[model samples]
Target: MPRRVSLPSADDLFRPTSPDGSDRSPGEAAERPAEQAVDQPADQPVHGARPAPRRPSGRVRHDEKMTVYVTSEELHDLEQARLTLRRTGLTVDRGRLVRAAIALALAGYEQDGEDSALVQRLRDA
Candidate 1:
C-alpha cells in the first residue's frame, strides 16, 4: 500500500489576508496601521483626504506570483544593489527589493500625480 500525502484545500490556499477580521474591528479594513494613521506630519495630507499611498506589506509570505524578465544589465544592477544593501547591514532578497521599489513608485504617483518621477518617466518612455 502507498502512503498518501495531505495537501491544502483551495480555501486554505486562498484565505482572506487583508486585515483579516479575526482581531480587527469591521472599520479597521479601511484604516491604516495605528502608527501610520496617527502620525500626521503637518506637511503631509490626511489619510482619508487622499487614499493613503499604498505601503509595502513587508516580510510576509506572499502567495501570489508575478514573472518579470529583465536584461542581463538590469539583473547585474539588481545584484549589485542587493550586495550594497548587505554591506550596509540590511539583508533583503531580490523579491523584497523589487516589491519595495514598486511600492515607492506607486506611492510617488499617488501622492504627486503628474509631477511624480514615476509619471514623468512613464511619459518620457
Candidate 2:
C-alpha cells in the first residue's frame, strides 16, 4: 500500500497573514484589518475599515489634426523605413515613425536647454 500525500493549491500558497497562525513570526501579523490598510498611513491611527475609493475612468477628447509637408525624397525614405520595420515583425506607419523621430529630436534639444550658452553667445552680437 502507498501513502497519500496532499499538495497545496496556489491560493493556499499565497494566503494572507493570519492573526493567530503559529507559522507567522512573533509580533509580525498585520496590525490593522486589510480594508483599513489604505486609509491609515504607517504613522497614523487606523480608523474603522472603509471601502476603497473608485478611480476615475481614463477617457479624453482627441479632436484635432494638422497637415504637414514633406519632400518626395523624404516621403520615399519614410516608406522604406516602414517596410523595413514590417520585415522585422514590427508594424508602424509613416505618421508614427515621424512622431517618434520628432520626440527623439525634442528630447535632445531639451537636454541642451532651450536657452543654451551657445545660443546666448550667438545672440549677444
Candidate 3:
C-alpha cells in the first residue's frame, strides 16, 4: 500500500484567483458578462430595426469530419477549381471548395424546392 496524501477540497481547487487575493470562484467569474450576452439573441439589433441577414463567416471549426470518394476526373476538376481560386487570390483547400459548393447546392434547393439545380443534376444522373 502507498502512503495517503492530503489534497484541497473541490471548492478550493476550482476557485478563481484575483490579483488582490479575493475569494471569487470560477462560478462567479462565469456569471459576469455571459449572462447579459446569453439573455439577448445573437442576431437581434441592440437598438433599432432588425439587422440584415448574416452571411457565412467562412471560418472552418472542423467540429465534424466527413469522408468522400470521388473519381479521378472529379478529383482533377476539384484540384483545378482550387487552382483557379488561388489564381484569383482566394487561397483555400479543396475541402473548403467542396464545402462551399455543398452550401450553394443546399441554398439553391431551399430556394427553388423541386425546381432546384441540385434536384435536376441528381435526376440527370
Candidate 4:
C-alpha cells in the first residue's frame, strides 16, 4: 500500500491568523478595488475642493517596492520611533511608519511647493 499524505484543507490554509478575525496578508489589500477599500461618498466631488488628507495605506496592500538606504543613526532613530509608538500601543511596523512619513512629506510638498519642509531639508542637506 502506498503511504498517503494528508494535506491541510483550503479553509485551514486560508484561515485567519488572528483570533479576532482581522488577519490579512499585506498583498491582499492590493487586490481590493479602490472604491471598496476606501470609503468615499457617492455624492462627493472627485476634485476642485482641497484634496482629502493623504492617509497612509495602513495594513493595506502595497504592491510596489522601494529601496532606501539610511545611515546607522537614521536607522536607530527609526527603530526608536517604532519602539516609542509601540509603547503607546500603536504597534506599527517600520515600513508602515515610513509610508506615513512619506505621505506627510508629499502632502506638505504638494501644499507648499518649494516652500515645503522636504525641499528645505533637501536644500540644507
Best model per TM-score = 4
Winning candidate number (lDDT): 4
Q: In each prediction, how many residue pairs overlap at the backbone (N, C-alpha, C within less than 3 A)?
A: 0, 0, 0, 0
Can you write out model 1's per-residue Cα lDDT over 2-96, one digit (the tens) per residue? 99999999989756556542333445646767665565554367666756567676666565789999999999999999999999999999998
Off by over 4 Å in 2: 1-62, 114-125
What overall lDDT, based on C-alpha atoms, would model 3 receive against the true structure?
Answer: 0.71
lDDT of candidate 3 over 1-125, digit per residue (tens): 99999999998875545444434444555656765435665445577665434334254334467899999999999999999999999999887788788877866776677999999999999
TM-score between model 1 and native = 0.60
Question: How high is the CA lDDT of each candidate model?
Answer: 0.78, 0.58, 0.71, 0.82
Ranking of models by TM-score = 4, 1, 3, 2
State TM-scores per candidate: 0.60, 0.41, 0.57, 0.66
Candidate 4, residues 60-105: lDDT per residue as tens digits?
5445899999999999999999999999999999999999999899
Stretches of candidate 3 above 4 Å error?
1-57
